[model samples]
Target chain A: MKLYEHEALGSIFKKYKIPVPRYVFSAEMNDAVRQFVDKEPGVVIKSMVLVGKRGKAGAVKVVSDKSQVEKVFSDLATREVYGERSIGALVEEKLDIEKEFYLSVTYSTKDRAPAIIFSEHGGMDVEEIDPKLIHTYIVSDVRSVYPYQIRQFLAGIGFSDKELLRPLSEVIVNVYNAFWGSESRLLEINPLVVARSGDKRKIVAADAVVILDDDASVNPAVVYGARSAQGRPLTQREQDAILIDQGDHRGKAGSYVELDGDIAMMTFGGGGSTVTAETAIEAGLRIANLTDIGGNPPAEKMYRISRIILSKPGLKGVLVCGGTASNTRIDVTLGEGLAKALDDMNAEGKLDKNLVWVVRRSGPEYVKGLKMLHECFVRNGIRGEIYDSQLPITEAPIRLKELLIKLVGYKPEEVV
Target chain B: MKGTVYLNDKTGIVVIGATGREASQVIKESETLYPGIIKAGITPGKGGSSELPVPVFDTLKEAVSDPKVGKLLNTALIYVPPVSVLDAVMECLDNGIKVLYIITEHVPIRDSEVIYQEKVRRGAIIVGGTSLGCFVPSVGRIGAIGGKDPTVAFRDGGIVVISKSGGLTVTTAEMFKRRGWGTYMALAIGGDIISNTTYADVLQEIKGDPRVKGVVMLGEPGGSYEEQVAGLIMSGGFDKPVAAFISGRFQERMPEGVAFGHAGAIVERGMGKATDKIARLEAAGKKYPVKVAFYYHDLVKTIESLGVPRDFEDSTTEHVKPLYSTF
Candidate 1:
């Protein structure tokens, strides 16, 4: 789940015509913030970070005087909330709150459906509020969340006034539509404030937290363009990996996270790689990085990944493992790709002679691939052990550790 | 009996998007293993031309309407892109295709939901949206699951290897193969967010098969599929001596909501943690004689202890020899 920050969510709400206060998002007290505050004397300043509970963290403040806006924004900008520095501060026109309601649409794993949770009491913690006051409805389908159902749900939660229910139901329907349309996992509007401006009253979302489903193919434009899952920015290595993945159309290749460890590891398949990583960690091995190579990528792609994994500093050993081969040829991944990469590194005198390598693979041409990899290791004078499909997938990491102990006299740490 | 299991030897097959690279390669390889099984190929606007013995038709309806191809199209192997998978699946379901192997990845979740709902309504079985497809050793192979060589990881046996990860399917099968055991069938159910078929669903069908004396399941964290399988076992629906391996234990230590590998392999709000799956499956195993393998090697050992058949050793050598020549 990738969460859109306050400014992004506010923009989305505005685009959908859901009521929200006019806001300016900026890193500093720029022209936009100046103009936004000039129009409204009273403004609410919020640190634009993905983490919640900003009010409790002192990341949000209500500034009644225009002179206090810059100081509040600057103070919030310098402080890190929940370990994430504020990307910017959302300066918005403060509303005259008459009442507050809470509305959220999210998928319920237990019900296996989209659920809408609404409460009359909104701005504060919904969890602490009386459970009886909260109304929950699990929509069988997003398309089938009818106005009658919404009205009934609202009425049950003490929203009985016809005029109030009329606009509330419309907001409910639109919120549901937006949730479903965006394929969002969670769309929460806390403090769905009923504001009074002179004689007119309107319901507006004061704060929004929208987490789009990572599986959904959301429009890049709507998502504020190529957002990172880390909620900040991509590292140089991650960016390079993404570029390599984009460079090829042939098998799937990407996902590289650098860690502080000596052993560089790459595993194949989704579940298999995680299991391998866990097993390595269990055996007192700290992983330098994690790379998933599957879909039978060509030799060149494998070569690139192997190069990247090897390039990481403090690499004592390299473990390349995966589950049984389905369509991806084991020979291509190891023999033609990784083995070649290792050979090239060896020729350049970049590879340490004592650096242990463990290759465990299954699938097509297991014997031949293992043979090629074995020969390459011998030729490069790189100490390594190779296992075929016969060995269980999880055993490779332990075996690598044992080999590291025997060959390099490396002592296993008691980290469990 | 809940849904059709179209992996048997008698079931005929068709290759949708047959002219595509992956489809054509798998078709050619499958012919060597299970000859005469692939009856028809469908590629829009590429009809009249033949992909060797299998005839190419413009649409599924065109192929199903032909007298020679009508009766031999029970299974449809879809090789269309992710965007077109839902339509391709609907076409197969409409044409009375009992089983669909959706061999595409990155299919939108909304589209997967529609495909899943339609499959249930029609009492049909779907293998995957990102699946490597299924391989029934000696019967036939669908998709490119077994690689260019099927014999490396597969052989005729009593164990049924069902996995969310396609790569693990081969690994589990090979584990049995090395132990002088063979699988009754290996189903790569695909590690997608919305799998058309779940482990429990497959377990229900495999439980009835007399040939399948035991089962090997390879599961990953994310979703409740493993929990559901545990439920089925606890409820006495699955009677076989099951050896299960659930991966992604390391994900629990990582930050929540970061996808480890597959899109489906994610731990959210601590719901689908690997430790939880292991505990649930282990608790259920205590009541129903289930064996949970924390490591892949443990799974291999558990299967080895379950006395089935040791006739695979001779066949393994013979089958593996032919594979060397293919390269």
Candidate 2:
């Protein structure tokens, strides 16, 4: 789950006591945003979208004239940056003239440990800076990392100004705390500015780029509503599929991303789903969605996902494929779960008899599961066949393509 | 023996979160393949009980104190929840358990970092946090690699398989089974973003093992694990043929940073893209016997083109004369 700038500032930054510039966010010219712009000498108007590069995308603007505040806010709020429309716009108090520093806490996969990357040079084009200008520390323990160590490192890095060292180092340490506390995969503060306001001096995080741990058990994930793979709001069917794994840890059928295709994909397993989707797409089967349904989700979960998958409009076929499961019982997921869903939908006259079907699954009780599912197909008059381990896991998608061409009248010219 | 660092039939096992329903099923199913290997269970309050097939203990400390389990307890299979994974792993590391397979998922990244530190400190082999486990078809199983019936999914032969996805681990093995050269050892190293046992780490370990002939790798997007394996093969660390099939190529066409389900399986700004991984592997193929399969089913054909033996006969055994018996 990736947090929007407003969310990270509100939920994580304040909780960790990371000093942040005063800001107000709203979808419209609400009183909070209006009052914030009126009181502040200057404000930075930022579009509240999860994707990055707001400035390059022309979604961020600075307003000094009070007359232009509402204009800028309305413009940013209504703008679509990088294929994602703004949820809202964040009006923040513009910081004073200051020096900027870079700090981020993330797990460096190369080192296989948490890494704190600090750079004396920060702000835009920080990536273009000299390699030696940046300093990195492999954090053995985030808890044991003290302020003095960072303060000393700051002093050693030519930031001999004793005043800037303490506040800067403290915020750097607080970023780590915020990262671990929020269970974030990445917590980056580019241009952690050393700004002076009137007679007061402060160190503030000017930007927050956070990628929270996607695990459902995480605090942020629990608090924040789910977003689509495109980092946009979920569709109605996507929203419906999410409830399947809300409180249930039994298995995982909730991970579904709708695509612009006709075939409703109910793929299983993280690896299995990927392999199946790749084969399905390469075999010229336009997959409607992608799901990592494995760990043997219950019949209820399976039934819910099946309904959501079938509910998509303009479905040419339904392709349910997965690799040979090691532990996931085929009978429960396919037979009891998916078969029941087919029966219920058919009874409701919601089943599309014209849509072709192809299912390939294996694992515990696969024989019984395939038999039950095949019977459901027979009863519903659906054009489909069931396959077991004898079929190469990748062959299912090709089989679906062949059936689509022969039965559904799909053209071979569409083949990639 | 599978390998010195790996599990075998004689490896005494301890199950964390043992009394849980899923753990019980894993214990029951695993016992069928390697009976009596599971010596004890740890549930933090189920001490002195026999709820699972093995004796249940309040903690790993109590389980290790018992003379019956202490000497033989060398491997651990953790089925605990995400939060308790670090502590459970610490306990196992402290108990001198050299080989550990963690089956838990959604483990916080911080916990994984700490586990990585402890694993380095103790020099223990840690498999997964979201792994289905590993198996040596010739010896026994650890975790839930082969499901209920090992024979249905796995057959002991020559090729070694290392997959990030547990389901593909079995699929890769089944793909090899049809060609008559069944998997010698298969390890589902987990789909976690911070994977402990990578393709390179496992490849380095199994490189010297006489049983495994060719390597079958299943990779997803995200992380440099596959790239690291290519580096290893190029450096001549592993002198065996390798065939790899990387998935999630279609996502590269969608968007840069959309994490398609698996956190590790993502294409972010040309980094960890299927195209880059394939190009790297193909580049390394010039240095060693590395073949990159564009399609999943075509992976076996790539390995077969490398001239890997169809059976589990090392070069030494291939030339030995058989003893004649009196009829």
Candidate 3:
């Protein structure tokens, strides 16, 4: 993930060959004060927290008098911004403004590619903008982007003014290049301030967010800062799970949450789990969580992975899936680790009744593992039924749908 | 004896990288192949190691070195990746290894090219660069360890399969698996291409094998491996009935300069389009029928209607147990 400081964000406009007011960053307020004391009114002093909504959070300020700079700086410097542990704040010179807009390039988890978005009305909660009004374009291949396509997108967004159109178009193309070039996940410029529409329209980002790419193994210098923008970007428990993965380097581990559903899942491989999760979402069941037990994780490590996932209080059930049977070894028995997890949850009455486990595995030692799972379920008296491979992996979502049918008091063959 | 014919009674096969899941699925796949031998897994560090019931050794040399080891046995499958594949292969060669099957993907094209040159020098028969490995019905199997239950898809039949995508192999196999369609043998020579073994190599093997009457080839964009195989077919290299499928057509509608899926697909530019491959197949022969399937079910139907000879008396009754049960 990329962490672009306010100053770096200002430089992005310069890189795109667009115009922007001067931006400077310093560890101490005195250096900032010394640099800005000579400047008259129209200087903006903003607390630079990595989190968003600095305006709502009262971290942004407009200062004209030199004497008031210290109070404004002190108020934001010492105070916690956005209720997050305060990191630091930034200060910038105010733009001679006329209009505000929003533009961004983000990787769509759904499409599994980079998408560019633009909004004529910016400087507000982007979420509030009608998706229909927002223009989006998906780049299927990394190599296919062109400057003309970006220009077309700007025209489609209804930018009639030539002066505004040219710079906005340039910014769009640059951001797309920057995203693909740097492997950034998100590049957002809110309040894409436009200084009037006709002759000398200046387009500048009053605020910006650059989330570096996570999929590709690009060096951080090519993207943004090494550390992520500060916030509880993940739940405390999710953070703990990441810690476990890092702590146990022997196993392949990672956790991610798709915003669409409530059914938390953990499986293996880079692709199969995604396909399975997509199937589940397509099947209309909520995905509570997403995790992967990559590679041939030892039995103990498998237990640790399972424990971390089960520890999440909001999870409903998990779909323990693996790569195609031929490609890799999938756990057949649910294994000792998972069985132990079940036992612990049972002991503490933590195994939720709505819990439905679907497993599809092949490879060596499958029978023994399956035998162990049957015995575990019998011993635990859990309301569980196992479909031990009388079906294919694709049959999993279909079978899970059946189990859900039983739980919701609907007929087993309910179309849903 | 061709298309993974077993000369012995042993049902189990040894995988060089047995610690992997692919090896496991291959073990489970024996039901389709008509089970006989027990699988033995061998890794480098864990000699005398056992992941399941199968025994694992530190090295192939150690595994085969023992005097107590009986018979030349069935083929040995290798799942070791590209970086370490050369050593795994050399060890197999040094130990008097025969009937070698490799399932590893992305063995640097240069490395494979070298291996091919070495094989020609040594006169050793090696199969694969990107292979799903191979399956021998009613005897033993190697590579792509577990997939649903191979038994459901593969049975004693006339249809023989050689595919380049591992997932497509399973999907193709699943067509028969779901409908109880059986096959004499199914080999997934995965990835976009293989350096040593091409479709022609397997076609000759299948044509010679009395059990196989038809051959199915699965192709993706990038390499001309499939086209080379087609050229051999056009020149009357083998008389076996052939059916093929070439995917990645959806890639055309997508803007140029965009990646479709696998890294190998980057070459789907200019003349390398999916249509070109299909045209090449048609030009090869009127009998060489090629189907297009973006989805597995569609591919399954295409295989079902190929009009290949059937071996199983009853097409629907056999329900192969899953390789492993989740319950």
Winning candidate number (DockQ): 1
Best by lDDT: 2
Question: In candidate 3 chain A, where is summed lDDT lowest over 10 consecutive residues?
Answer: A221-230
- Over A1-416, each residue of candidate 3 has an lDDT whose tens digit, in order, gives 44635644655545655455566654457765656645645567677666667788877888777778777777776566656544455667767788887788764422334678787777787877876778788765555677677777677767666565666677777777665554455678787787643455677767767654232343343344333222424565455555554434343454533233445576554334444554565566666665545445456666666766766665545576643444333343265767777778778887775666666654445566656766776677654445444445545765666666676542322223
**Candidate 1: segments with Cα more than 4 A from true spot:** A1-3, A98-102, A108-113, A117-145, A152-164, A196-201, A213-215, A218-227, A247-249, A343-354, A409-413, B1-4, B51-53, B233-239, B301-327
Candidate 1 local lDDT, B217-242, one digit each (tens): 88888878888888888888987788
Q: Is candidate 1 or candidate 3 better by lDDT?
A: 1
Q: Is candidate 1 or candidate 2 better by DockQ?
A: 1
Candidate 2 iRMS, in Å? 11.3
Candidates in descending DockQ order: 1, 2, 3
Which segments of candidate 3 are over 4 A away from where they belong? Answer: A1-259, A266-275, A289-296, A311-317, A321-333, A360-363, A409-416, B4-132, B138-140, B144-153, B158-178, B188-299, B306-309, B313-327
Clashing pairs in 1: A324-B171
lDDT of 2 at B265: 81
Worst lDDT run of 10 residues, candidate 1 chain B, spans: B318-327
Report the C-alpha lDDT of model 2 over A50-70, residue by residue, as the tens digit. Answer: 887788999988899989888
Would you estimate the TM-scores of all the predictions?
A: 0.89, 0.93, 0.51
lDDT of 2: 0.82
Q: Write the per-residue lDDT of candidate 3 for residues B257-309, one digit (tens) a residue.
A: 33323324433225356667777876775655444443323445565566664
Q: Higher DockQ: candidate 1 or 3?
A: 1
